[model samples]
Target chain A: MEKFKKNERVVALIKILSDNPNQVITLNRFSELLNAAKSTISEDISAARKIIECLALGEIETIPGALGGVKYKPILTLEQSLEFLKRLCTELKDPSRIIPGSFIYMSDVLGNADQVATIGRIFASCFKEKNADYIVTIETKGITPAIMTARAMNIPLVIARTGNRVTEGTTISVNYVSGSKKIQTMSVSKRSIKEGSKVILIDDFMKAGSTIKGLKDLMSEFKAEVVGTGVIMSTAEPDHKVIDDYVSLLILNDVDETSKTISIIPGIK
Target chain B: MEKFKKNERVVALIKILSDNPNQVITLNRFSELLNAAKSTISEDISAARKIIECLALGEIETIPGALGGVKYKPILTLEQSLEFLKRLCTELKDPSRIIPGSFIYMSDVLGNADQVATIGRIFASCFKEKNADYIVTIETKGITPAIMTARAMNIPLVIARTGNRVTEGTTISVNYVSGSKKIQTMSVSKRSIKEGSKVILIDDFMKAGSTIKGLKDLMSEFKAEVVGTGVIMSTAEPDHKVIDDYVSLLILNDVDETSKTISIIPGIK
Candidate 1:
């Protein structure tokens, strides 16, 4: 390999660190890869750290002592997060997004890479200190944000399915009444999670919080604990939610079908 | 904002480019954000480009003429890709992964963040030239890889569900035969995809190519063209396949029930 200058080394370092957010990269490894001394690597990291902080991209924390190194944690300021949610509210207010049953068409928003990345960063920032062993979510629409959050948090994603599949091995199933008062069964492969694991649940939308309650029940089967719950949007219709302690990015306050108007506000933590 | 040095600029530039891979970013935008002259921005980009090329991270191409700028395209050399697939094959060979009905339990692999990112990069590199308007996949298991690919390709992800949901306005449904000769129906929201668009189908696994066929059939209903297809794994049992043209990263050659041994190899493009 060719020798690299400090500028080149910094670029490569940023690439690697950003790609594996929340994971520590020891100084020894950087020194070995860049063919530089620990002091040189330290200087490079300091410069990179300063840039990241100045740009408000994220934060780089240094852990001292053996088995210690530096790690990057993505952050979204309150103002930035509020601005994003406001934009999301504007997008959701589109009358065409209104569907039967007063559901907003957010498939496009959920499927967008940029929007998903931003939302994931916000959720990951909120749950960064949970010491979560895994990021859990129900299958389908929630998978995108869950995957993004898992990536940001440097954890594995465990998806619970609506039903059992033959390929999933032995599965644990739990039945919970959905918001619509329908009894729905949710399943997770027994091998997916371990006992005594800490998990954070994420989802695209929460109506009556029935799905989240179902997930909590399913997690209990594996002896796992749901430390936190985050949702992209939650409706206001369900005055009584099954799960009270949770965080939502946006709150769907009201949707007037007759006038084709929808009201939304930033969620309160 | 304070003035940033070359090292800081390069780090920020790399972060922005890597986050939005395959998207052209104008020099003017960088200059404005960095509060630097176009010439200085160009110099910084040149240094960044050199570092990226030297490390074999990816390519930074500069487009000439009006409406032109720099675009980052992630690349994985054949050696790197083969190494990754080989490791994946080794992981899949675990005897305990063999489940009932001769299926392999790979939910863990699909749920893994690092592995999913690598697989997504390989798929994105393969289909980078397809000019796909959307990366499409079925709901559930395939969503992780599909979302990763969409992020890498800088495109929107479109997930087709097993059935229609009231939340998804009008949906188009298509029925296709499964590998076991059973009938299955798949549907996509009418608003999710536009007419006369190009799409690529992705999945976690393929058995007799039934699901890909279903996706292709579903795409036809919307007047969308299936530009390409990619899968993480495909079975060797099916002497004949439903889809003739598709790419698989790994091929499951055999899985012995009695001995609890499995055989796998990298699939040919």
Candidate 2:
């Protein structure tokens, strides 16, 4: 019998396992395939586990029953995704977040990596079931997470600009009121969206839900349906309108600069 | 000799290896520590690798050299970061992006998970070197990436809200021009930024750099030093009064809504 080399044995085992996702491949059968001793097979199995773990491509599980074997899981949990966003909100909510009128400063958290991962995951999970054809958001801050989410789902994203421009093609503009009682028009070009598409509305924050409302109105011209909405953080204040079935990772209750105190609550749905 | 349980042995290996990030660990040393046969130690190492990869913590390396040993590189590469962002940006450059004259809709991307990951890695790589004391951005879209970036760097993020609210704290406002004609007053609370601190500016776009300049002026009152600036996307048409060290993941070139052709260039910064 040819003695099995460790590398060769491990590679052979993975090939066999690839044929069976979420199924346990028995150790005994694996040993026979590699024609190696039980201990040698065990070593090879362990090596294979390491390789898979490092890649994050899949998972390995060991079954304890009589016919048990190793299986793999390739999904991320909802809590794990939200935890990343919460961490970002927590760190960003430091005393320095204290700005006049109880408003906190938070641009830094949006630009960081770990936090971005959290935001992307949370939004992805919300839209995963929708099979959204496209992702849409207002320009500027909304672009980061929108782009991140679109890439993850392998969908295209459309950005709505605030003003009209000649270079953008045809135009459609809608008027909306701001929190400051100012009315402004937000626009999306004619050629930007396809007719009869499903869209997921995304924003950094939802104060009055006016901007999202404007976006929804803009989507109407394209005959697009807004499947869902997502936000990283939101104020729990009652005066604001809420987008149905929307998700936010953090809820800001109060932010004070002089006293340097911020009240934050974990967000759900 | 009594043998260590496979799970315990695997966990121990992971602990040791993780503690020595980006460094090589010899197989002999591993065997000695686990007090197991060389074959057993090898098996344990492989098992541990599988778990790490699945968790998305990092990676493992095997060097085929006389002096080479198994090494785990905990760091993720820049190319991987950029690739993720590029994929994200491509999907986001949809014709649906054009709003009114030429604005692109992107709130969805900003709120999604994959986009968050791309934004996180980009900023993490950019500020991976800078010991950023704080992350700063104005309200709205800028907040998403700012929070994510700060979380990746494990730093605090501060946000400056628009308008004056007395309940928050004392604040200062700066006048900046937007749309080249209108004078807009953007405010930052006095206590938001610390004195003589290093801050990285984060924003969603840089059409005119006035928003950034307004933030810079606000930071001046606190005597905060502006370290750098970063954006998820930029037009690159030189709309800004002055441009400094900045980064963008995508560039919107032309949005022909009528023709349904929106031109884009992947971010160079």
For each candidate, give the TM-score of chain B: 0.96, 0.72
User: Which residue runs of candidate 1 sit more than 4 Å off their true CA positions?
Assistant: none
lDDT of 2 by residue, A7-113 (tens): 54554466445323335678788767667777777777677677555533345677877897775443245665556556665786678666555656554445444
Per-residue lDDT, model 1, residue B110, is: 89
Worst 10 residues of 1 chain B by lDDT: B176-185
Question: Per-residue lDDT for A101-220 in model 1, tens only?
Answer: 878899999889778988999999888889999999998788898988988898999999887788899999999887678888889989999999999999999988999999999999
Query: Per-residue CA lDDT of candidate 2, range B1-269, in tens?
Result: 44555654564566446434435788888787777887887777676566555434456777666676686544345666666766766786676666665677665555454355447556766766676688888766666667656655556667766666543356677776754557777776565566899998888777767778888888887888888788877776765556567777677667776887777776753
Which regions of candidate 2 fall more than 4 Å away from where they truly are?
A1-116, A138-170, A177-182, A204-211, A231-269, B1-127, B135-170, B176-184, B189-191, B202-215, B229-269
DockQ of the candidate models in sequence:
0.83, 0.15
Query: How does residue B147 of candidate 1 score in lDDT?
Result: 86
Error of 2 at B121 (Å): 4.5
> How many pairs of residues collide in each model?
0, 76
In terms of DockQ, the best-performing candidate is 1
